[model samples]
Target: MKLINWWPPMLGTGISLKKVSKDMTTFEVIMKLRWYNRNLVGIHYGGSLYSMCDPWYMFILMANLGKGYVVMDKAAAIRYKKPGRGTLKCVFHISKSEIKEIRSEIDMIGKKDYTFTCEVMDEEGEVVTEVDKVVYVRKKDFDFEALEKEKEAGNTKIPG
Candidate 1:
């Protein structure tokens, strides 16, 4: 995907894509918690805070894993450490070599799942949120004939 299209979502929300690596393993995005992103208590809006991290890791996964594999968010968890003031930054990093390894495994075993974790840090480098993402990946083409056989035996339910 082009960086131009990637900028709007972030800029629209007052966030910025500060950096993205050539290997697609690491990215840095920044956000300024303005009035629109403030809660009743004047703290940063939770949704906006969460938005700072959206799609970055998944994008990285998609870019590195190549085609014929499915990469999804799967799940996420965030820890609000200290309240954000001024601006906040989320630095996302993945291991390109590790992704290569995962791809190798998927090619070898046909199907495999992997998890990658990244941290969002404030300017002081204090982690504001720690996110763990699980992604399921497998070869796109599988034994459809086996599935058909199972269906013929009434052991499977085919979706209409």
Candidate 2:
């Protein structure tokens, strides 16, 4: 979590990864309004608001989905409900049962789009921005353990 807080994009935009739950199911991020990140009107910039939400849903899914599945961000839409001036924060969480539900769906259909909504709120606890994110999840077609075993035994071939 500390390393992620220092990530270049987050640092550049004054975003911070504030916390991660012990179960890896929940994450908190904050963007404090600053001179460098504000728009001409002196409120939070749309890009900054979008940036705060850009990558968290994918991460939440990845942490819960495990190694046998592939997860990628598909699409996003942000609706700004009101002007934001103070610190803005968002919480990203996916229940373990929800993860299992996603896995079942992928297993049954091979691949599918899953959508989650994240809301950015201000100090007064009113929503300032709403972000809808779509994630693409698919189960790996081959056994990863078997492929690893083949590579360890020097029997796997690679195309040059």
Error of 2 at 9 (Å): 1.0
Q: Compose the digit string of candidate 1's lDDT tens values, residues 1-160.
A: 4464356666566777878888888888887777777789876777677778778877887888778877777666676777776678877777867778777776555565566666666778887766666667776775657766777898864432
Model 2 clashing-pair count: 0
- TM-score for candidate 1, please give it: 0.77
lDDT, candidates in the order shown = 0.72, 0.87
Off by over 4 Å in 2: 142-160
lDDT, candidate 1, equals 0.72
- Top model by TM-score, which number? 2
